[model samples]
Structure formats: C-alpha cells, structure tokens
Target: RKYGGAIETVLAHLQESEERLKNIETFEERKEELKKILAQQRENYLISAREIHDKRTKAARRFEKEVETNLKAVALEKARFEVRIDAPNAADLQSGNNRRLTAKGFNQIEFYFSANVGESPKPLARVASGGEASRLMLILKTTAKAGDAEKSVVFDEIDVGIGGRVAEAVGLKLKELARTQQVLCVTHQAQIASLADQHFLVEKETVGKKTRVSARDLNEKEKVEEIARMLTGAQITETARKHAKEMLGAAK
Candidate 1:
C-alpha cells in the first residue's frame, strides 16, 4: 500500500513539472515584453529625476540667499555662501543610459564658502574655521518661524575663537533660537552660559582607579556663582559675581 501511494505522489510531481515546462516555453516572449515595459519605466524615472533636480536647484538658490543674509547677523558680512549642484546637464540626462546615476540620483550638492572678501569660495568643510562652521550651522538650522516645541537643539563650543561682542551676539542668537526649540549649549563663554534658562556643572573625578564624569543642575545662587566662576576661573572674585548677577538680571 505504501509503494502504491508513493507512485501516485510521483505522478503528481511529474504533472506539476510538465506545467512548469510549458511556462518556460513562452518565457522568451514575455521576457521581451517586460524589457520594453522596463525601458518605458526607466524613461519615466529619468523624467521624474529631472523634475527633482530642478526643484532642488531652485531651493538651493533660495537657501544660499537666506544663509548669506543671516551670515551678516553673526559678523560674516563679507563672507559668501554658495550651493553648488553638480548633476547631469539636460543633455547628459537626456542620454537615458542611467549608468551615471547614484542611489541618490544624478545630483551631488556641496556648500562653498569664502570667509573674507577678495577670496574665492572653497568647500565649506575645507575652508570654514570651527567658529565659522558653528555659526553657519546655527544659522542654517534656525527657522524664521517660532515654536518647534518637540525639537531639542544642542550646541557644543559654538563660541570658539570668538569673544567680546561676537560672543554676546552668538549668545543672543542662541537665546533667540531657543524661543522656537530647546537649546542646550556647552560654552566657556559666561555671556552665553548666563543666557541659559538653567545651569549645570559638569565635573570629572577619579577614585580607586576609576574615573567618572557627572553633571548636576544648579540653583539660582549656584547658577550665579557658576557664571562668576566661568568669568574668573576658580578664583571667583566679588566683581565677577556682581557682573554675573547683572547678566542674569538683564536676561530676566
């Protein structure tokens, strides 16, 4: 009985194999049809890609203008920011080979910058100093609209290589930006730190061959004292405390 059942199963398998061979016989005709369909789809993709490139070009121009305008606010008045979009020109795109395209498409966008007048713009990464990059990033991320309530922005050492009025300007810029989003800044500048809504003291200590870094919040008095400490280092003179108080009062 088992041998009989096995023969019947083998017959069912042979029937399925014959049906699959029939499909293989017609596969060449279907394959050619699919190739033509895919070619049409490829052309459609190129058309859509061109539209995306055009939109990005227009948006890049607007973004460049906006960045240059805000550059003046952070003392980069003479600096020029440019957005360079390198893509297959209309002729190359029309070639329809699609071999030159990357996963991100045919466009490669880059930022160029000149930090001073009479100098030609170079790539932003190669040319911009830390402070310049920081301010540029801040301006780029800043929105003209208010209330990005769910977003938190973090700034680390944005005040580098700047001091006096420029530092104050940067601090004010952070304050203004904080109105829209939560701004967390790490800075040695008392001007900037004093503008913060809350203050934290971060300290590192070593014990029994283990080292740890910890951060703790400061109260109103501790915040004032901490700002004063930033102003005068570990010494914390009375004059610096008074100045720190004045800064806090001004913030209010």
Candidate 2:
C-alpha cells in the first residue's frame, strides 16, 4: 500500500511540472509575436522619415540653384549667394507642439549680395552704399522675372547709381527683360527712361489747399518736353528739347 501511494504522489508532481512548462511556452510565443509587430512598426517609421528628408532636401536644393543661376545672369556672377532657412518662432508653433510652421516650408528666404568682384557677399541690409543696394535690388527683380513666364517686372529709379555706359547697359537689360515681362520704369535718367515702350509722367498739381497727384501718358511731342525737363531740372529750353529728341531717337 505504501509503495502504491508513493507512485501516485510522483505522478501528480510530474503533471504539475508539465502544466507549468506549457504555460511558459505559451508566454514565449506571445512575446515573439509582439516583437515581430514592433519591428514592423519601426521599419515603417524609418521609411517615412527617409522619404520626408529626401523631399525636403530636394526642394531646398532646387530653390538654391535657381536663385544662384539668376543672380549670375543679372550681373552678379562673382557675388556669393546664400539661403537661410530658420524655423518659425514660438508664436508660430502649434498650441501643444514645439515645432513651428511656416507657409514657405517651415522657413524664410532672404537674398544677399556683394558688389565688388572679390568681396564676400553679405545680407542686403548690410550693404551701406545706396547705389549698390539699388542695383542689387534691380538685379533680383530682373532675375525673378526671367525665371517666370507669366510675371511682369517694373523698375523705379533703378539707374540711381549708374551713368554713362553703365546707364546704357541698364537700359538694354530693361529692354531685354521687357520682352518677357511688362516693364514700367520711373526714371530721372533720360538715357534709362528713353528705352520705355510707353512713358508716363507723374506730376503734382495744387487744387486749392490740397495737392493732387496726376499722371499722363506722353505723346511723342509731350515726351520730348518731359525728357527735356528731366534733363535740365525745372528749366525746359528749346535747345534742351531738341537734345532730348535726339537722345530718344538714338535710344530707339
């Protein structure tokens, strides 16, 4: 009887051990399944991150290349060009997120230039000379028109720093650019203004106590008078008008 009882106890212990081993095996299988799911999710996240990075990098590079090419073509070939992409400030961020957002792909772009051939290019605000800044601004406007097919460009006092041949060059550039865009230039330089397809004059008139602004499109004869006025300041003479006519004819 004792031997039989000992056998029964041994059998019971063996069954208990088997049950525990089965439970452990089941837990390990579940754990392996969880690991596979986590790995898949991580792989998907990596792919998405790579795609975003590639897209952002490509857009930035394209914009940089276009601006650089345009700058070179607009007489700043030796000038260095740079693009700054700064994240939006805290005010621009979402309510709960630290990341800021901007309409221009989370960044803003500013153009910088250097006038001297060997000088390092700096921000547009850093350029101190009035003439250099005017020309730089003109070059940027001209470049923007060249890159687009459906845009119009206007130049107001763009020849402020240029004279002689440089003034003539400015005129030619304006004419060339006008072939692709509508160019309206308000200029004091007869050399520059004479190249316009159509010229309008802005004059101030006193109506009682208040001054009113008036503009008129000049006819051929009136255009001569206006050009003469520009040439001689407030004094228009017969000789000056004739000289203005000659300059206009030469420009054509």
TM-score of each: 0.77, 0.55
What's the distance in Å from true for residue 195, model 2? Answer: 0.5
Q: Report the lDDT tens digits of candidate 1 across residue range 1-252.
A: 433468888788789889999889989998999999988987777777778889999988898898888888777888899989987777776676576676566788888999899999999889988778888878877733444879987878688777777778888888888888898888898988888888889899999899999999999999889989988899989999999999998987
- Using TM-score as the measure, which candidate wins? 1
- What would the per-residue lDDT of candidate 2 be over residues 1-252, giving only the tens digit for each residue? 433468888788789889999988799798999999977865565456446546766766665566566544444455655555444454434232424332234445565666666777677798626654555555555555544547765565576655666676677767777777777676788777877788889989999999999998889998898889878888899899999999889877
RMSD vs true structure, all candidates: 4.2, 14.5
Worst 10 residues of 2 by lDDT: 94-103
Q: Evaluate all candidate structures by whole-model CA lDDT and list the values in order.
A: 0.84, 0.67
lDDT, candidate 2, at 55: 72
In model 1, pairs of residues that clash are none
